[model samples]
Target: MTVAPADDVTGEYLALRTGAGVVADRFEAVWIRGADTTPFLQATLTQDMSGLAAGEITRAFLLTSKGKVRALLWVLVGANEVILLCDKGRQADVLRALVLLNVNMDVTIDAVLGPVIEVIGPTAATVVGSLGYDVQAPHRWAFSEAGHCVAAIGHIRVDLPRFVLIGPSSDVVRNSGGVFVGDLAADAVRIEAGEPQAGRDVDDATLVHEVGALDGAVSFTKGCYLGQEMVERIDARGRVNRRIVGVVVGTNVIPPHGCEVVQGSAVRGRVTSTAESLYLRAPIVLAMVRREVVDGSAVTLTWDGGSAPGTVHELPLDTFASIS
Candidate 1:
C-alpha cells in the first residue's frame, strides 16, 4: 500500500502519527515443504524447527559454515508449506544456498516475489477488526482465506502480516485501512523496539549475539545447525564481547550509520541506526558497542559534522518502562 496525506486524524490515525508499519519496498517469498521439511530446515537454520507447529511463525538466521549470519529469515509454517521471507537483495543468494544444500532431501524451493503489504499501529487491530479478520498482535501469524492475506502484529521481524492483494496499489491501500508509514517512521519504531534490520544492523560478518538476537533466533537446545558451534561457545563463555545497545544522543544532530561511538580516546562501537523518538522527545540510536562499554555508561558520539554526548542503555531501551 502507499501513503497518502490526510488532514483529519482519528484516534487510530493519531496512534499512527507515532505508530507505524512497514511497506514491502521489495521482498522475495520462497516456499519449501515436503517430508524432509523439518530435517532440511533443521540442518540449515539456527532455530529448532522440530517443534514448530502449523500457523506458527519463527525467526531464524541462515548462517555460513563459519557461523556468521548470511541472511535473516522469517519462517511461516502452513499446513503443508513453509514460507521463507528474506530481503529482496539477498533472495537469489539465499535460494541458491538452500538449493545447493538440499542434498537427498524431499524438499522443494520456489521463489515467489509477490506484493507484500504491512499494516501496524495501536489501532492496527481496529483496522484489521473492521476487515473481519482477527489478527493476534505480533508474534502470531494468521491468514485470511477470503482476502488472500497473511498477517502478524508486534513481531520484531515481519511486524505485520503481508497480504497478497492482487490489484492496483491504490486499491490495496484503501482496503488495508491502516496508515502507510514512511521508511523513516518504520526505522524509528524498530529502533525503539530494539529490533535489528538485516543489512543495516547485521550482515554476513555479524554473529547472532552481537546483534542482540541470540535469544530470539538461536536455539541452544537444538541439534547442530549451521553455525551452532560458535553460537553455543559464545553462550558458554557468558559474554558476546560486543553487543547491540541503545544510545540516547543529547543533540538532534543524528549520527550516520557506522559513525564512531567514543568514550575519552577509545572507540567503543559504531552507530548502526538512529532516529528521532516522538514518544521519548530525543534522538535515540542503536549501536554495536564493545560489551564493556554497554553497561549503562556515558559516552560520546563523534561524527564528521560534530559530536554529541550520550549514554549506553540496554535494548528495548525503555526509558518509559521505569516510570510506568
Candidate 2:
C-alpha cells in the first residue's frame, strides 16, 4: 500500500494512482427521507442521532430484538436525508426490517447501488487530493463538493487504510486520477486492520458489546433502539462473556474462519477472519475469544494435525493506532 501526503486530494483519487485495482463489489446506498427520519433511526440503531449534524457519518449496528446484529452500517446524515451503506447480502433484510418498524412514521427508504465506486488504500486520499478534494483526516468519513463523492479514512477491518466512494461511476473514474483496487484487496485490508466484518465478526448470534466496537456503534446516551436494553446491561456489568481480539500467528499458514481457538485443553474462542499482513510481515487474525482469556497474552490455535502459536491483542490492533 502506498502512503501519501494529506492535501486537497481525496482517498479515492489517490487509490487510482497507487496499484490498487477496483472491483465491482456489490454495495447499496439507501436513502432515508421523511419528517420522522431522526426518530426512525434512533429507534432502529445503536447510535444516538440527537446531535447529528449534516455530513456527519457514524458507525452503527442494526440488531434483532434478541440483541444479535442483523447488519452493520456506516451512516451519513444530510439536511433532509440520511444514507446507509450496509452489506449487500443483508440489504433486503435491513430494508424490510426498517419498513416494518416505520408503519406509522413519516419515513421512506430507497436502496441504491451501481452508481457508486469504492476506492480504497493508504494513498487513496492523495489520489482524491490531486482531483482537488479535501479529505478529512484518517478514521473520519466526509463528502467532497466534487458532485457525488464521499471520502473516508479508516481501516476496512484489521487493516487501517483510507478509502473513498465516488458516485455516478462515469464522472468519478474520469476524475479519480488513481488506480482501482478490487474487493479482494479491500477485504485483505480489513483483515489487516483487525476490524470485524459484520456477518463474519457479528451475526445473528453475535452481541454488540462483544466486539469491542461499542464506542463506534453504540451510544450510552442514545434513546432506546432495538437492542439497547441488552447492550446497556452488558455495559453496566463491565464485562462481556466473549470479546473480539487480534491474534498474531507464528507461521505463514492462515487459519480458516471458524477454526477453534484453544489455550492448553480449553476452547477459548473461534477465528472470525485471517490474512497475511502486507506491512506486518506475519499472519494476523480476528477472533472471538472468551473474555476471561482475552488479556494480551500468549495463546494457541489447534487445527487438524497442527498447532499455531499466537497471542490475543486488542481490537483495531496497534497497527491501526496511527491511521484510526
CA lDDT of each candidate?
Answer: 0.69, 0.68
In the range 1-324, model 2's lDDT, one tens digit per residue, is 233343322342324324343434445667789888988898889988878887777778888987888887877777767888776577788888888878688888877655655555555566556556676655455556755646463443445344546464634455454454444345555655556766677778888877665566788886688988888788789887988888888888877778889987899999888766555667788888898785678888877877788878775554544442
User: Which portions of model 2 miss their true places by more than 4 Å?
Assistant: 1-27, 129-149, 153-161, 170-177, 320-324
Residue 317 shift from truth in candidate 1, angstroms: 2.5
What's the TM-score of every candidate structure?
A: 0.86, 0.83
Model 1 CA deviation exceeding 4 Å by range: 1-22, 132-138, 146-149, 157-170, 319-324
Per-residue accuracy of model 1 over 1-324 as CA lDDT, tens digit each? 324465322332334433334354534667787888888998999988888888777778899888887887877776666777776577787888999889999988877655665555544555556555665545556566563446462445333333322112435456455666556666666677787777788878888878665556778887888778888887788877788888988877777778899987999889999887766667889998887794668999988878888878777754223211
Assess candidate 2 and give its TM-score to the true structure: 0.83
lDDT of 1 at 108: 85
Candidate 2 residue-wise lDDT at 152 = 66
Q: How many backbone clashes does candidate 1 have?
A: 4
